[model samples]
Target: MNMREKTTKAENTPADKVEIAVRLDSELLEQIQHLTNDPSKVIEVAIRQWLRGEILRDDELTRTPVRTPVPPRGEWND
Candidate 1:
């Protein structure tokens, strides 16, 4: 392996990543960085779960005809 490959930061990055920028308060930002090695992955999982719940809730409503709220994360579908 060449030195360039060893030094590259994109080694584990997905090929299709959407660039986004957020401004975080200093304390919360530091807490996340210090507590989690991969904050991006944590955020990604959270978003995916939220989207999944929405989709599931929509399908459920169509079949049941009741205005029930979607179960919180890690509840109905884990």
Candidate 2:
């Protein structure tokens, strides 16, 4: 059993949160390391990307209300 196999089995065990694996080749891993060495950050970015695509596919992320642009200081005079 390799490191990944162990991780997969461990993730399968019942827990409060389920886990998913993202397999990267050596070259890809090196590229990611150039940007960040934090594994949690990398996982978070991947998950966010997945959710973005899912929401877009379902048309659920559309029509976010735009916030009113803030005026320059003294321009608002509020």
Best of the candidates, TM-score: 1
lDDT of 1 by residue, 1-78 (tens): 887658544555577886566776888777887868877776678688898874355656668565879888889755
Number of the top lDDT candidate: 1
Give the whole-model CA lDDT for all candidates, comma-separated: 0.71, 0.70
TM-score of 2: 0.36
Q: Measured by C-alpha RMSD in angstroms, how accurate is candidate 2? A: 11.2
Clashing pairs in 1: none
> Candidate 2 residues 1-78, lDDT tens each?
776556554466568555567787889888878888865477677778897874345445566778999888888755
Off by over 4 Å in 1: 1-12, 54-78
